[model samples]
Target: MNQRRQKKLSHHLFEAILTGDARSTKALLHRGASPERRNGDGTTPLYLASVQGEAEIARLLMEAGASPDIESSGPGSDGTPLCAAACWGHTETVRQLLAHGADPNLREDQGTGRTPLEWADGGPHPDTAEVLRAAGAQPSPHRAVGAM
Candidate 1:
């Protein structure tokens, strides 16, 4: 596909993710919308899907090769997809992200920010915290950023 078409598909893909439209997301991705493409908010399709708790969309993005651990760029609560899901108490989304290799212990902002566990723990979500803890997430928040 041409760059123009790819760009359009990517744009539409973001809309589909935001709306939790799994069918559209899947079609767009099948037509070559990049799972790795970030929106104007600097969030990938998977990240947005996680924030929206769209587990089916997230799974599609992952199957399309979205990096589960990639951080968001736009100024927002979202850092990693895992962080987005955890903070929102999206247990299934968190589980999907972890299964797809998202780093449960990874802090946002290159490690200086909160880990998924911390995000979960701080939120009104004990179940999310439990998921992270089961995944081996750490409780301490002072890890060196960019040390990964």
Candidate 2:
């Protein structure tokens, strides 16, 4: 397929994942949309799914060959799918990513070098933090100014 068409499909897939519509997401993927393709804002389908706690979508993306650790583009693009999941307190998404080989120690590109653990720590998800720690995530020495 042409790059333009593929990108369009990817964008649609991104939206489907964001809205937790696994059916459309699956249809898009089956139609040649790349699970790893980044959206206009540099986020991937898996990242958006993770951020929204769409565990089933995340699993489908991973099973379709999406990298658990794919980084976003542009400035401050250090956010991995794992980071997005952790930041949003998506425990099941985090578990799925980790099971898919996501790096627990990944830090945000523009943040205070906070790992998934740090992000989870500041969020309302202590269980997420425990998952990160169990997966070998370590806290960054300097927390973000607003980090809890």
Candidate 3:
């Protein structure tokens, strides 16, 4: 596909992910849209899906070769899919990412510097915190408050 078309598909895939539109996301991926394509701030489709707690969409992107540990490039984009899911209290999404080999100990952006477990603990999701703990995730030393 041409660069223009691919760019369009990339944007569409991002939108589909944001809206939790699994069908559109699948179609875009089928058409060769990269699951790892990023927005201006370097957010991938998988990351967005995790943030939105769209497990099915995340699964589709992962199946299409989305890297669970792919960190964004821009400033404040140092978060992985697992980090996003954990921060948002998305237990199922966190589970899915973890099953797909997401790094439970991965830290977020510089300011936060929090691991998935720390994010979960800081949030209102005990279930997600338990999941992270079960995955062997530890909190960053700097943000150790409320860590499980």
Candidate 4:
């Protein structure tokens, strides 16, 4: 496929994942869609799925060999799939990512100097802090959660 067509398909797949349309994601995957194709924000389908708390989509992507630990590249480097899931309080997605070897303590120094845990703490998800702590995330003084 041409790059433009692939990019369009990737964007469509991302929208499917975000909308929690598991069937659409699966259909796209079966059509040879890439799980790791990143968007303008450097977020892949897995990352968008995690951020939107789409567990089923995330699972399908992971089954297709999506890397949960794929760090943001180029302009955006502060979030991973694990970070997105944790920040959004997607417990099942986070668990799946961790089981697939997503780094809990993955920190990006994209001027924010914030770890995944710090970003999670800043989000409204209550259990994210606990999850981060359980995953060996160190406390950042800037984060309001104050070390679990």
Q: Considering every candidate listed, which one attains the maximal lDDT?
A: 1
Write model 1 residue lDDT over 66-131, tens digit each, in one string: 999998887673588999999889999999999999988887888677788777877769998988
Window of ten residues with lowest summed lDDT in model 2: 70-79
Q: Give the poorly placed runs of model 3, Cα more than 4 Å off.
A: 73-78, 110-112, 140-142, 146-148
Candidate numbers sorted by lDDT from highest down: 1, 3, 2, 4
lDDT tens string, model 3, 53-137? 9999989999999989887664554577888898889999998898889888877664356678877888868999999999998
lDDT of each: 0.85, 0.82, 0.84, 0.76
1-148: candidate 4 lDDT, tens digit per residue: 8888788888889888868999999999888788888888776788778878888888899898898877656354346778778777888888778777777777654435556677677786668768767877777656555543
lDDT of 2 by residue, 5-100 (tens): 997998789778768899998899899999888877776777778878899999999999999877765344447778878888999999999999
- Count clashes in each candidate, considering only residues at least 3 apart in sequence or on different chains: 0, 0, 0, 0
For candidate 2, the lDDT comes to 0.82
Q: Which stretches of candidate 2 lie over 4 Å from their true place?
A: 74-78, 110-112, 141-148
Residue runs of model 4 more than 4 Å from their true location after superposition:
1-5, 73-78, 109-112, 140-148
- The estimated TM-scores of all candidates read 0.91, 0.85, 0.89, 0.77
lDDT score, residue 21, model 4? 97
- For model 3, give the RMSD to the true fold: 2.6
In Å, residue 35's CA in model 1 sits off its true spot by 0.2
Better of 1 and 4 by TM-score: 1
lDDT for residue 43 in candidate 3, whole number 0-100: 73
Q: In angstroms, how far off is 98's CA in candidate 4?
A: 0.9
